[model samples]
Target: MAELEPEARDRIMDVFMARYNALHATDYDRFEDGPKGTDHDYLCVSSSGKAPLKVQHTRAWADPETEWRVPKDVERLIVHALQRRLDERKICDRHVSIRVDSFPPKRREKLALLEKIWMAVEFGLNRDWSNPSLQRLMRYERNDWTQFYQPISPYVAELEILERVPPVQAPALVGWSATGEEGDGVQDAVFRTVEALKKKEEHYRGTSADLVLVIDFEVMPYFQDELERIRAALAARSIDFREVWLVSQWLPVSADQVWPAPNVQSADAP
Candidate 1:
């Protein structure tokens, strides 16, 4: 795969965002030319203006969002975009594609993964690449690499291979992953909720009534020790869990029905 031309990168994002707006009509609205603190080409929000979720703006997939393994070409676009953010906090929206930073290979690799391990974990894109319908979220037309969204797909399936979601005698935890991967800081996330509730913080009103934790597959190892503690605390609280899903692992589906992806072979990459 060759690096994404600046034109291709922008177009790809526009297509995904267009779909995003159509799907999240009530929940989000899209914007261009970057919003105040966002510093990216696109921004969207719900909740009277909150962080946007997938379809995560493509550039964001390289920033506050976790990084994934990408083909060399598309990876170049991400590097170029991040440089603008790290340097001037400005992105040129015209004819600017196909630039890979000249960092030592190791340094670039570290930077690529740096955006990961933040809070949420992702999987499944590669799993369904063989399916044509899933192609948009998995294989890229511009670079034949993986496609991912920030905030994860709200529709991802949660397969509880082991631990069951705790009934919350408490409220859902009120923090993003401090470390990217949810399990790494699962305890902190839980304790944060406990503290807020104990203090009777009005802002946390009604949280004590339920706890919803979204754990990612990568966060699994971190849970090896603390999952039990979390379960015990929630058990004490008797909060009913809303849902527990393994995100990005299964073919996507919305509240209405599952989306079918077209089956395309790797040989089909242009």
Candidate 2:
């Protein structure tokens, strides 16, 4: 590879580093400007299809009773917000697109994913980008090349990789599924419960419980580990977590204060 000039090398490194950050930052909300102190942001989707990508931010959260629409212009905003965020880190390339059906439940899941990419971009946009730092981080730079054209060596690529770290969200209460003799029915119920919790959690992401414990006939063995992983991931981005619990068959001994819901809403309810 031809050696890159000093200026060219600096510019390329800046682009690489900024892009790395935007993809992993804890802040995931596309509408929100700048990074939130906590790791991870809640993504809201309106199932009614009332909210378009271009839907106004205020309208989306207008009232609990009113259904919000995603506006048509959301794709453009996603790209714009992402690019602007990426630019802050000195990344010049704004070219990007969403793959098909990334968010399956969403009417425009692809756009949502695109918007997510922008949100990821926002996480890494505001950081220091300097050539000397790059050289130290990269460990390999073309010293023989002329000022106009200096190339990055192939071996040096590995060094650059070392400096890159995955963005993390800490102690997240992801989704849940029940397993046992009542696997199907229990799982279905848990899914609905988690979805409800997710909606409520949107109002508060970082300030609430980061752990969700469901006392059930059978709980997944990896549940706690998974939650910890989420916490580590969010910690990288400074996001917090809130925990939720679903109790089935038997409640936790310590959860004497917690109570189960009455069976008023049946599964077949229209």
Candidate 3:
């Protein structure tokens, strides 16, 4: 693949930063100590630098003008940014730290709706339904029609901390929940694998070296929005890696230089 132009890289970074804001939305007003006790922004710090790279000291929901286009859910937005970074093959070693907390009441409600819609849609398409009518009801739930509500959350937000990992150890890391025909196959698989990896990583203190792999599966485009939300969800989690790589048939190209990605991991056994 060809290199990403500086403009493209900037756009990718913008997306990465905004996505992080969306994912880290939490309830800050509810904190008794106010903003100090609450993590109102997506906090990213590069510890290696003499001074940290500070993007802004503002919340994803607030701008000088009106609020952001996206309502801002911490998990959904951050993961979306991270996923974009991975898709572009931009994995850095900049000792980056991300913290998403402090959401408004409405933002919390929006997140719940997004998650519920996503799960409902995923179930309708991926799981078996003896009665198609019930499945349809779940897909077209009542709350879906409410104002300021959407089936999927907008994949945008604010940028707090930005750090680019070094050029070395840029191996890609693409995680998918592997659930589909066999009860939400790819999504389930990827979710299970990540959960297991998380447990194992914590268990071994991040010392496992097994080449991650996935079984066969397919998903309909009917749930593209849901998939995007799911991707955002996974990205929000602060998963660590020394030299991680993400490989997928959907986006086989690591052409997005802003992501700092290495070669793709093979689906077949290495």
lDDT of 2 by residue, 1-270 (tens): 123345533332233223222432322122221134433222222344322111101101211221111222333434355445445555432223322111123547545555444433233232345642341121212334233222212111111111222323222111111111233222333333333444444655545444222222122211322333433332343222323322222221111101122122111101
Model 2 quality (TM-score): 0.16
Query: Per-candidate TM vs. native?
Result: 0.19, 0.16, 0.19
How many residue-pair clashes does candidate 2 contain?
Answer: 42
Q: Per-residue lDDT of 147-209 in model 3, one digit per residue for the tens?
A: 322333232111122222223554333222211123312334235324433553464454323
Computed on alpha carbons, the lDDT of every model, listed in order, comes to 0.29, 0.28, 0.30
Candidate 2 ranges beyond 4 A from true positions: 1-105, 129-132, 135-270
At residue 11, give the lDDT of candidate 1: 43
lDDT ranking from best candidate downward:
3, 1, 2
Off by over 4 Å in 1: 1-6, 26-30, 35-41, 44-270
RMSD of 1: 22.1
Error of 3 at 104 (Å): 52
Per-residue lDDT for 1-270 in model 1, tens only? 113356544444344434444443544544344444432333444655755542212111212122233334334434343334434522121111121122223656545543431111223211334434321222111232233432222211111111112322222111111122334323352453343233332433554223222222221212223444544554576332232111111122111101111122111011
